[model samples]
Target: MRVLVCDDEQLARDRLKRLVEKADNVEVVAEAANGREAIEQTQEHRPDVVLMDIRMPEMDGMEAAEHLSKIDNPPAIIFCTAYDEHALQAFKVHAVDYLLKPVSLSDLEMALSKARTLNRVQLAELGKEVSEEKPRRRGHISARTHRGLELVPVDEVRYFLADQKYVTVCFSEGEVLIDETLKDLETEFGEQFVRIHRNALVALRYIEGMELATAGHHQVRLRGIEERLTVSRRHVAGLRKVLQSL
Candidate 1:
């Protein structure tokens, strides 16, 4: 099996590479220093499995796994971290296994044996777990594009517009389509965003003001974008209360 080694520290990567090489029929395909590189290398190399570290600069493994899960025929994820606390979160993202630091060759080999692509049902179940766990909000949001996985800083997001089955994340530069539900997005980012309508959530910090858009209808003006989103009458009072505290 082809494997990608991802860890911030050189020593950790080296050790993982050595152990991976020891496994029967397994070869070290590439190495990545952080979660961002991990995703890039995975896209370029098409590794069968990734030995992922949970904590790293730029992006954490959990967030990286979320992005990887979107790719076509995503590589199996096996989290290798020093901390034990993230084990649940690791499995929540559908990792093949969780291996702690100072990993043993036997454990690594056993984990490698379990590598397999996740099915749509498993991915759907993971989404449900993510929403239910209310995992710590990530700093950036990831979307798969033709070029590969793109990371959009959560702070740059102007708003989230939900259609039937997809949510469009509008950030400072542009917009990207994502599979997350609006309700799940609101639940995870409630502090930073507010629901303006059943179909939309606007960034609290980006709200320029509110005004009447048409007869008996209201719209919200956001700072970075020209388009004005309609504010549902039912949510207007709640939006006002949230805005007042901000």
Candidate 2:
């Protein structure tokens, strides 16, 4: 099996490479120093399995795995982290197996043999669990592009529109669809954005003013965006209260 090693430390990467070389039926195909490079190498080499470190400089394993899950026929992911076993129960809940740091050869073989491919739903769940545990929300949002993963800084995003299961993030450059719920996003970015409608969250910084859509309905006008989103009757009251506060 082709395997990719992703860790921030050079020593960790070297040790993982040696162990993977000794393992039967597995070869070290690529190595990455951070989660961003992991995504790049994973795309280039198309390894059968990826040994991902949970914490890294640019991105973490959970975020990388979320991006990797979008790839067509994505590789199996085995998170290798120094996090305590009990703390990693969330990963196990979603059926994504993990190995503790200082990985044992036997554990590596077993993880490779039983590594399960993560579907979009499971990946979404994994992201949710990670978000719930994090003390601060992620500074950037990741979306799948035609080439690879795209990172949109939370500050650059102007608004978010919910479409069924996906949230379309409208940013300074353009918009990209992501597998995150509107409610979850509102909770995470509540300080920066306000819920304008049940299906949309508008950034407070972009708010120009409100316009009347019809007799009683209202619409919010953003700075650069010409198109305005409807303010549902149910949400109008809360939106007014928020606007007054602002």
Candidate 3:
């Protein structure tokens, strides 16, 4: 079994590496100092399991695990933390097990052996619901492209158009289909984007002007995108006000 060890402390990571070496059939594939790096390494290495540290800087293990869970196949997670209280709470999500800091070799082996599959996506959802602190809003989304995970900066995003289950994320480079809902995108990026229609949330930066469409209909013309989004009757006034402010 391949494993990626993630911890902020160098000593902690080194100790875990030495201990992991003793376990039969287990190979340490990568090491990450923080949750963001952990997510990147997991994608690059495709490790079977991640020894995740909960209290990490930039992105906590819970949030990183949540993002990683969005992929086609996420690794089983075994949370390794200094806190014991987390054991009671963390299992509710997708984590296969939690190991207290200064983990015994036997416990590590047992945890690895017991893991049939990584924690479920529901586990990550539960983490979001419980925490008092919301996960840091990502400046870029990891959009899966034909080239793999493409990090699309939020600043470059032109608009998000909803079509049934998927939302097409239009950026400066191009557009990509994502599984995210329009409502969720609105909540997350409300400051940057405003609702122009029931089906669309457009970036304020991309709004060049509005033009009158056929028979009293209104359309928003974005800077670079060729598509002219129809402005819903209910939202036209609000869109005008937002544009007027800028």
Candidate 4:
């Protein structure tokens, strides 16, 4: 069984790596310092199980596990934390097991055995439960590409353009296709992004200004990119007000 260990503390990760190495037939695939790295490592390694820490900076373990659950053949999660308060929340996300801090080798092995038995259907069910709850406003958005899963930091994203069923995420570096609806994106990132058109959402921080494109039509100019997006008639007034405030 392949395993990834994630913890904020380097010592904790080292200890877990040692314990994981001792487990029969289990290899320590990778180690992550926080939840974002955990997700990236999981994407790269495709581990069968993840030993996660709950309280982490940037992104927490629960949020990372929720994101991972949406992927194909998701690895089973086993949360390891010092606080017992997070146990209920851990089980709510359908963790394979929850081990308290200073985890024992025997307990970890049992959890790994349980993780190995989790079928796709079980992981699917967990994903559904996570989706039913209020969608988390993430610091980063994930996209599945031929290379693998790509993570785009929300702060760096300039805009989201919806073309039929797919949403194109324009970031500082480049753009990537994501499997998210514009309406859902609007709902999740309403504070940071504004609906400029029916098919587009522009980041408030990236908005340079609005210009008249043609007779009675206007387009928004973004800071990082030259491509100007058409702003709908209904949203023109609101967008102008947003720009004024900025």
Q: How do the residues 121-191 of candidate 2 rate in per-residue lDDT, one tens digit apiece?
A: 55556545544454346667878778677778788899999999899999988899988899888888999
RMSD of candidates 1 onward, in order = 2.8, 4.4, 4.6, 2.2
lDDT measured at residue 198 in model 2 versus the true structure, 0 to 100: 80
Query: lDDT of candidate 2 vs native?
Result: 0.79
lDDT score of model 1? 0.86
Candidate 2, pairs of clashing residues: none
Q: Please write out the lDDT profile of model 1 over residues 1-246, one tens digit for every residue.
A: 789999999999999998987889999999999988998899999898889999899898998887777677677889999999998878877788999989999998888876644554665565455435545787788787787778898999999999999999999999999878898888889889999999999999999888877788899999978999999999999888887887
lDDT of each: 0.86, 0.79, 0.81, 0.89
For TM-score, the strongest prediction is: 4
- The local lDDT score (0 to 100) that residue 175 gets in candidate 1 is 96
Off-target runs (Cα >4 Å) in candidate 2 are: 85-96, 116-145, 163-166, 179-181, 187-191, 208-237, 244-246
Any runs in candidate 3 off by more than 4 Å, and if so which? 83-89, 116-140, 153-156, 187-192, 204-228, 241-246
Comparing 2 and 3 by lDDT, which wins?
3
Q: Cα deviation in Å at residue 104, candidate 3?
A: 3.5
Candidate 1, residue 85: how far the Cα is off, in Å = 2.5
TM-scores for all predictions: 0.87, 0.74, 0.73, 0.89
The per-candidate count of clashes, in order, stands at 0, 0, 5, 0
